[model samples]
Target chain A: MSVPTIKFYVREGLLPPGELTSPNQASYGETHVQRLRLIRALLDVGGLSVAGIRGVIEAIDDPRRPLHTVLGEAADQVVPRYERGDGSGIAEARKRVAELIEARGWRTYEGSPAAESLATALAALEEVGHGRFAEILDAYADAAERVARVDLEYVAHQVAREELVESVVVGTVIGDAVFAALRRLAHVDASDRVFGETP
Target chain B: MSVPTIKFYVREGLLPPGELTSPNQASYGETHVQRLRLIRALLDVGGLSVAGIRGVIEAIDDPRRPLHTVLGEAADQVVPRYERGDGSGIAEARKRVAELIEARGWRTYEGSPAAESLATALAALEEVGHGRFAEILDAYADAAERVARVDLEYVAHQVAREELVESVVVGTVIGDAVFAALRRLAHVDASDRVFGETP
Candidate 1:
């Protein structure tokens, strides 16, 4: 049966209640229960309304379009940071960032959030005094440029216009999530390193 | 006033109403409202109840206690990838991770949530594939290592141990907020790139 039909059965409580097994009782097996729960989760927690959930369920059931393809498209909506060829000269970009920060009405100083974050991570060194921060930032800048260059080169070579656009959008969204999650993981690892030493 | 006290006032409607001059107002000046909101977010969204939020707030506010120190302590809660030290020894970790995936009843070959996340990343290279969803795990490991190394190398060399912890924690947390805000600046870059004449 179609997802809508299944959803209708669930909504009207026509479907057998989950886990009701006895000598005389109606019950859905694990797969049915799982499908119903998954549908519910997609509707409730995943923030898809009934129709969207049905569409998703339909997509999952249809093998012609892989679940991975659908999910990749879905994941693209929330996080995209990896796509390349988005351009801004370093100086112009820095100036624009400074403006954005100022527009937020935050205090501005050499050590201000404005200068520190807007100015390509030079401030990380400033905390330990200028010399050290500068050295590290220099090293980082070189590595970063290489990464960007390589990223651009790869994009140019591998992707066509349509695929590039999709990758750009999806990559940008997922990439941010990836980075944020990674950063959180980093903090967790640091804690583990400091405390966990049972080798 | 203490955070709890501030929250109590806000909840009780004891605080003066904020000026609606700006679109964003929470019945107090930005700082008070922000402090209250931060406390609330920590308590509510962060899964820390009032008491837990209070502890974190106290740690942040107490001049005697450093923020970075607390972060180092908190960071310990993150799970670690326990493979042989070399990246090459990822096989055992892979097996362990596969077991974890199976235990969770997650499908590895299809577009399961986990696969959607880590599959493309795993497919990037053989080493990456070994651990299945190891890309994220490794990205996190790298970010963790970089941040920790930066934290330790820079922080340890400067400041007393007590001061170092506070500064590092504050710096890390604040740096995160700043970095995120700054990264938004990249959108301008992105727009310029997309709209700019083809290079």
Candidate 2:
């Protein structure tokens, strides 16, 4: 939290400007501190770019926006866009993603960014000759469902609409990191058990 | 994917140089192509750095490295290292991570990179006044265990030790991306269900 970084966020409109108490000085409130903390959390831990953070903060501050719309935008902004490719692997992967969604009875939107992200990963797996990895889609979806349920439960507990929206944005991004780390730990444990290796 | 990128990878030792077929001409084989794809997948899709890809390639090329050891190294390499902090939030988050691991009966190493990563996320959440988000740890870990079982089972079916190691590396990295995407989709569905919003 350097002065320059704080100034940068304020300049970028990711954080609100402090109130001017004098010609040469501004008085920062607790809200500014909290906002700065959230900004840092999103940037450092969530691995979001400045532009991505701006989008999230804009969604957070815009009361006219619907909560679901805000969440969708935040999630979409965080995921990298996949370029349209004519590769068969990508086409097949897209089909696989749709089938997985259908098989799992997930009610995601058509052309969901998550679906595209999954498709990109599947295509990459196929490109690397791990096409068979798609076989684990069901398992991955099952786990995803369970985690998502927990996330929604937490967000639903928020009484304030603004808090709920912010929770969804933060939870979606930081929760991904948390779950990924947990998955890695679980992988280590499972691999050790399967191979008879001591931890 | 480009000539320059391939040359860069070769220079970085992340990809091996092509064999010289003549005084001024070099030819690459299937191994080179596959290696190049793996490097690209790791860099472009897996979000690993050149140095991180180098570590993964080295692990893959080393026959003497045990599968679990190689997987650990690869997973460790992908996660950003957390700087030592004296903040109580970080210290508290670390304790929570340890508690979550113990409660879940996971056999992760004492200073496991996953644990550190989780602690870092937890700390960030707390920094943003979302310490209560740690409540979802048990649920996340449960889902993570289920996903890890499927991953290990898939790796176990690999006939060759090299394939097994590579699968773990790929599975740990790209699997995170895949699962994150799936989780986002699941989040959309769950949020819709909870808030009564149409997808």
Docking class of 2: medium
True contacts kept of 2: 0.85
Off by over 4 Å in 2: A81-88, B81-84
Task: Give the Cα error of residue B84 in candidate 1, in Å.
Answer: 30
Least accurate 10 contiguous residues by lDDT in model 1 chain A: A77-86
Estimated TM-score for each candidate: 0.39, 0.96
Candidate 1 chain B weakest ten by summed lDDT = B75-84
Could you tell me which 10 consecutive residues in candidate 2 chain A have the lowest summed lDDT? A80-89
Model 1, residue B165: C-alpha shift (Å):
4.5
Docking class for candidate 1: incorrect
DockQ each: 0.12, 0.75
DockQ, Cα level, model 1: 0.12
Q: What part of the reference interface contacts, as a 0 to 1 fraction, does candidate 1 reproduce?
A: 0.07
Against the true structure, whose DockQ is highest? Answer: 2
* Candidate 2 positional error at B121, Å: 0.7
For model 2, state the Cα shift of residue A143 in Å: 0.8
* Per-residue accuracy of model 2 over B82-159 as CA lDDT, tens digit each: 753546487778888888778778888757888998898889888777778978778988898899999988888899
lDDT of each: 0.38, 0.84
Per-prediction backbone clash count: 19, 0
